[model samples]
Target: MTSGDTTSGEGLLESLEHMGAAERAEHDAEVSAAVAPGREIAVGQGETLLAVDALTVRFGGLTALDDVTFDVRRGEILGLIGPNGAGKTTCFNIMTGVYRPTSGDIRLEGRSLARMKRYRIIQAGVARTFQNIRLFGAMTALENVVVGTDARHRTSIPGALLRLPRHRREEREAVEKAMALLEFVGIAHRAADPATALPYGDQRRLEIARALATEPKLLCLDEPAAGFSAAEKDALSELILKIRDDGYTVALVEHDMRVVLGVTDRIVVLDFGRKIADGLPDEVRRDPAVVAAYLGGTVEDAEDQEP
Candidate 1:
């Protein structure tokens, strides 16, 4: 054979070897993903459902969060609390993918959520309520909750427009589910009322109900007990525990010490954008650092370490 023919044969063999190596790499990746912890843990057996590692957020040199790190354990009520301007809401926003972190990482189960958008985050089994009451003012209470259930909907615009069999079935199911959620939150009687017409305490409950309609594994509530009476707070404490018992991992951000202590299995205290203490309710209550952070006293600062 001529020199050119020999060169062509050798080049074809090299190309085949490269293709085989690439195919093997792809096969290995598929096998790894099949055996990965994320695939198994997606069904919810891990100890930690949500984990934040060295989280920090900065708004033009104003550091809103400084290396905050914590985890929400599965099937427990975890309280995220601190004084005003302590970065609790910022942490909540980050956890819900409302704000991207300036550094560090967030993981759901073993899968990284660092690059997910707000809507994608919801699809990853997270839902949250705002600190300020937010509901569709013009919609009925049941309709507002139905909006939340829409997060789980897969119907296309064409299907919805055509009112196809699948779309009609899903619509009926969504309405039934929304009504069930309203009743669960003790507002079924007000289902036909405008969302804005509910009393302040009931409005808070409605927001929680709407969040629950999303069927999240992790529910983050921002100041849920705000503007509640003593009695309302008591009722809300029970509601939070009930949510936990219903197989949701609750991450609560609230100012009321009584509700926090009563409902939560553990508490993570934030001070000046840093976590000062984290432990069981009684342990955190007696922790000098937490006491100093809230009530203003001197306590030796413990080393800020990751959980």
Candidate 2:
């Protein structure tokens, strides 16, 4: 039941790669359903999956967030964008339970997450990747992803220690699902590699795959396209779209306008920890305050630059 086993990687991949076309299709469908279970709402529906209601955070005399309110719709990619020190990551930390809000509430499907433990929030079907890569340096990519699957596993520590049948079954299933997620993120070929040995872009992809391994209903990505080249950003855009297409709600906190505009259905602009705009991508891109706060320019100047 532990991640110490390395034989699960290539063996499972070889088995998957050897499947017939029809079998592979079935397996892929199963992976899709497992990764995002019970998420079948239309992308444009006004249903709210997560609500950040008048959320404010402060440290001493400084207010990092000020009554910022927004919602991530049921099946859309909502981009949260802002310049540095504008409280983008601060919001993420609050949503993920790394920090409790000084005031206001964060609700997932109308349930208050204020008092929930970090693990409980994760079990409630919200998972996130860090702004900085946080993969286990010594673990294989598959092993790292398998750790995420632990959140959904029902086996007890006693069962795991006793080598119980249910524990072994869960381990086998976790390995299969982890490999499928790696494949989904286009990194199955590197499943056996140590996470530290991967390239920067691949490491980002690995972190995403690990997050997906949690079977989350809403996936929050913080600066996923950071430090990527143009081509890598383009590829990341496609991957994010593919993820959304497979029926998961996404909250993307990104800096790259092109990546955010290309993949998100809507955008929320934050400035000085206050929400300045919340609308379609085009509208947010054209907002005077967004232009000034983010790009330090006018709307015309922002339009002249490539999105």
Candidate 3:
């Protein structure tokens, strides 16, 4: 090989070594940060990880959500479901700070999300997926996930332009973390492929991996199972539970009964901009109001059935 090739190879090895060191440091920082007072708002000791209290949203007389209230307990999956235009997405949007509430408030670990910007909400430990697939189609799966790791970027603009030591360190650390996230979401096999080249299901899993790259305390999924088949939905349910088990509080907005019933610890139902029910999956499933709203039939004395 040419001397130039040899030099490039050495540089690549150095970069990998630097990233390995940074990853170790990052792991330690994560442990310390989790227990650091003030840095962490202590969502663990609290009864709720997310609280949407009487949130109302309107767009020029179009009331999308009205006085919706619910709680997502720590390390649990809370399903938010309703029929078309039932304000499920609206509630999800407001909760993630995509849209401001017309009235009332939202809190994550007792920290009010009132009037917070979307990026600020993410930094405060909330991340969400879109109703539509939003992967960077032209980018590799790993690169797309690396975008989410920008939530932890600390390099100054000048440092990045100049390729300063700090900037190099941060970028390497981000790549390391992004690859780890891809493995966590079961997409490591496609890590080097263009995002658009993956199957639809893999794309969905990639989106979740991207969301996890931000290191969120609460992961909000908006209609994640919108287009999946029966088997895919079943797998998605297992993945959701695994996410919850991995120390995340998941809030799901899905229409698939397989996922809503099989995955969530609690389910909240909304109709006509109003919350009609909030309870365990079985209770919400059997509620006459929920059945009436979803099935469009007159209610009979429905008995509580287990999920």
Candidate 4:
């Protein structure tokens, strides 16, 4: 056959066997864009507080996260949402140093988080709340918050034994700071109450107050609105924004669509451990793939369930 004839024959066979030119070209473009070295997403109005690139985590043969990537801007609330097993919690785990990634990297303020211990991560201006409330039930709310500020305090056996002037001054400052954090979260009234004595909603607030006591630059909350009523959710949303307005960046993993859409400055949607969308709330809400993956096939499904 002539060269043109042979090329034409091969092209025809390839078209019949796989994606057409348009489909293949579009796929190639996506791959190239993903791997290309350029600005990923502009983090809020300033520098990025946290960035996760090609983050992958595995549990035995089950891949919990496959190249998940996103950014949380400084002084903004970034919502991370997905289905039950979509690795939302796992992402929080990796960020807080609860679990190291099998691959990829996590950075805080452009610094590597690899091999950092949980306490070290906290000391590096990262603090987190659990999906399940993890608080000291036996301790008063004030004491619980005081515990959060312990990392920043300079107390030692010698100081405790001798009651040094410096120790007293440090203790007083810590107590004042803890009280301020509790007041910031609007839970100062319950400061003297045992944590378990507070109502469920208040417990959630207490958890946030305690996390804030760490003086974190970036706060990660796992499902903060999980068991809240509508009013409670609204309050939680306002509190989250208030937290951000107070100059702390927040990364929240939540299931309540209303809370997520209402409070987040931006959002990253994951499905089956892979990112399907990342944009402003309205933009992500309208993304076709995000709708299908998160709402199970239709935008209508997502809307109908929106609170």
Candidate 5:
């Protein structure tokens, strides 16, 4: 091998050595599972992880979502962008079982999600963070995250009431995993603080960590960069990319064109509750309908324009 190749290999090894043990282990497991015999990996390359099919929602005389359809591919960041009242959050609400669609359906990996409860949806490997901060005000950040981990625990309420050995064991594991998630989101130092006490940006990160604790197949984030400054938005963008690299499918809904264009693998645009464009960032930016209705001009104009 060339000397330069050896030096590059050494650099990669050093970086891997510094990688978080939990992250490394999780990624290795995903890789191994993908190649294992007779095992259909939960996350597969270029496969559809979520399918929103002809979803229509109506409240009284108004239609919130009119036959909206899209799919989030596994191991990719899909940006869902639109103007205000364009049914973005409504879509999120339906995906997470917060609202039942007036017509149409949502499926995860070919399983129809109709009639599923909110908790059932979470258990089905779909987790989300709200546009507004929804952290538990009285709970410490670690405790809040632990609650998410509990969603995946198998111990029954009866076992927990009796303080059974299995419950005790799972509780310990939950705390450890929660701490690792806090570290992953760059807020391990604030693990002991109340969630409400965190700075606005830190609070947002904490919400993301909690959602990650559920070990979701698809992570839906609604306007996570809504109130962030430019630097905070950049950090958040990196975190989103890290989440995707770690084998989580992300569907991001944001108003900021810069954030959407920078991190998304594909863009899905909605205008007046209808899909106007769905393609790569460049294609969506140049589409005349998207440019006029949402971008407000060319891509250059959209960079400084907020939808």
Candidate 6:
């Protein structure tokens, strides 16, 4: 079926989607039976979900990321923070296959992603939202989320063309899943609204909902709290934690120190294309190098500021 015609079986799809979520939680529980199930692990404390080792990316004469190495453990929020030109975005580009690294390796669940195509990278269970919001502005919020779910549909082209029952069912399932995801992210009330018409905070939530629709194992959010008011940032923080609680890992590159410190389990600091610190939020906040590179003053000064 055409993308527009995929919402016919919402009831069946909603039920199926709930079943899937329950099943996923069960699977995760079984895997964690030896440990505590459903408890979010601390960064660096579990099996690696995404790893980069000695990764170097260069653009002609400038080295964007030099010898960057770190790992994102499954079921934790890993915050990547840096000053401008610290090569944070470049590192993301390399991991997401937007730019091939000049040297070194990027591994997702132990498989090297060197030189993989962008589409292949998505299929490999990595999805990202841009620093600047990217959305299908002309489409409704539901439609935008559907674009993300489109990749996971099992219907064949010929069957869709002929309007076969199975294809219709799959198409309907995709739309319902998209709606459910939007609801989960607190944007379902705006589902019928055009993306461009929503407020800025809603737009950010929509972007996240879309990315999650891809069913990615690792979700990378670039500057998700940018431009938000303090109250809005607080809500966004809750949304992020809820996502993590739902059983997906997050890798965030954010500028808001409050949001980063409030949401992340561990923080990775980058400066001049090199990793300067990686530790718990409190430890990273106190790290001299991290403070120098970005905080740019004494932790005492930071502590003295009004919250």
Which candidate wins on TM-score?
Answer: 2
Q: Is candidate 2 or candidate 4 better by TM-score?
A: 2
Misplaced by over 4 Å in model 2 are 3-29, 36-39
Candidate 5, superposed: residue stretches over 4 Å from native:
1-43, 298-307
Error of 3 at 47 (Å): 1.4
Instruction: Please say which candidate is ahead in TM-score: 3 or 4.
Output: 3
User: Which lDDT values do the candidates have, in the order given?
Assistant: 0.76, 0.86, 0.77, 0.78, 0.80, 0.81
> Mind sharing the TM-score for model 5?
0.85
Residues 96-214, candidate 1, lDDT per residue (tens digit)?
A: 88888899888988777777988888888889999899998877787777778777888877777777788766655555566667777788788778888889988998999888877
- lDDT of candidate 3 at residue 159, scale 0 to 100: 72
* Candidate structures ordered by TM-score, highest first: 2, 6, 5, 3, 4, 1
For residues 1-307, write the lDDT of model 2, one tens digit per residue.
3644445455645655666787567666776678656456664456998999999999999999999999998889999999999899999889989999999999999998876899999999899999889999987888888899999999888888787999876776677788878888998889988899999999999999888888887899999998999999999999999888888889999988889989999999888899999999888888898998996789999888766
Question: Best by lDDT, which number?
Answer: 2
Q: Give the per-residue lDDT digits (tens) of candidate 3, residues 56-87.
A: 89999899998888888876788888889999
Tens digits of per-residue lDDT, candidate 6, 1-307, equal 2654544324434544566676646544432431122344544357889999998988999988889999998998999999999998888888898899899999999988888998788888899999889997877887788788766777787887888898766655556666677778897878878899999999999999888877787889999999999999999999998888777889999988889988999999999999999998888888878887898798776665332
Tally clashes: model 6: 1
* Segments of candidate 4 deviating more than 4 angstroms: 1-44, 300-307
Q: For candidate 2, what's the RMSD?
A: 2.7
Q: Would you estimate the TM-scores of all the predictions?
A: 0.81, 0.91, 0.84, 0.82, 0.85, 0.86
Cα RMSD to the true fold for all candidates: 17.7, 2.7, 5.7, 23.5, 10.5, 5.2
TM-score winner between candidates 1 and 5: 5
Model 1 misplaced stretches (Cα beyond 4 Å): 1-46, 296-307
Query: Which regions of candidate 3 are displaced past 4 Å?
Result: 1-46, 295-307
Give the winner by TM-score: 1 or 6. Answer: 6
Predicted candidate 6, C-alpha RMSD: 5.2
